[model samples]
Target: MGKLIVHPDYQGNGIGTALLKEIEKDNSGLRQELFTSDQSLRNLRLYKRLGFVQFKIKPLSKDLNLVFMEKKPGLLEI
Candidate 1:
């Protein structure tokens, strides 16, 4: 999946989590991978909470980097 952003007004309402769960359910048995900015702590936490692990990091500039995360097949509990 690509960027999953919930509107700020609707943030913290489980919208992002539900979308991710649906994606996982649809792609069962396949590894799921995505990337986000290192500066996005909230995104990082959300991804980690959903079973994604950091497997790589790509530097973009002095103050920016891309964090690559992946969830192994069968790791989804919901």
Candidate 2:
């Protein structure tokens, strides 16, 4: 998972949601994942709102101030 970028002029307009919906439609079983830099709080919140849950948090080894946060679907209860 990597950072997704929307043109500055097109952001805050639900484009991201549309993209995610399309992705889901194309691959229903894919384990969607994303990694957010420490500075991206807004994106992090949006992911949470869309059913993604945090699975890992780690600091960037070279940059103490930078962190890597990953999110994906939770395990199913069998």
Candidate 3:
């Protein structure tokens, strides 16, 4: 899966979680991965909450970094 962005007006609803769950359902039994900016704390939290773990951190610049995260197959089913 790629980037996931829920509209700010709809923030705090279960949109992001639901979207991730759907992706998980579609790709059942397959490993999933994604990356997001280190500064995006909310995104990081959401991904972690859904069973993704940080596997890498690549620095883009002094103030920016990419956090790569992944979830193993059958790890956490919604």
Stretches of candidate 2 exceeding 4 Å from the true structure: 1-3, 61-78
Q: Candidate 2 — worst ten consecutive residues by lDDT sum?
A: 69-78
Candidate 3: regions farther than 4 A off: none
Each model's TM-score? Answer: 0.91, 0.70, 0.92
Candidate 3 local Cα displacement, residue 74, angstroms: 1.7
lDDT of 1 by residue, 23-76 (tens): 988998999999999999988999999999999999999999999999999785
lDDT: the better of candidates 2 and 3: 3
Global lDDT of each candidate: 0.90, 0.64, 0.91
Give the lowest summed-lDDT range of ten residues in model 3. 69-78
User: Which ten-residue region of model 1 has the weakest summed lDDT?
Assistant: 69-78
Q: RMSD, each candidate, Å?
A: 1.6, 4.6, 1.6
User: How big is the positional error of residue 54 in model 2, measured in Å on the Cα after superposition?
Assistant: 0.4
Task: After the best TM-score superposition of candidate 2, give how far the Cα of residue 7 lies from its true spot, in angstroms.
Answer: 1.0
- Number of the top TM-score candidate: 3
For model 2, what is the C-alpha lDDT against the true structure? 0.64
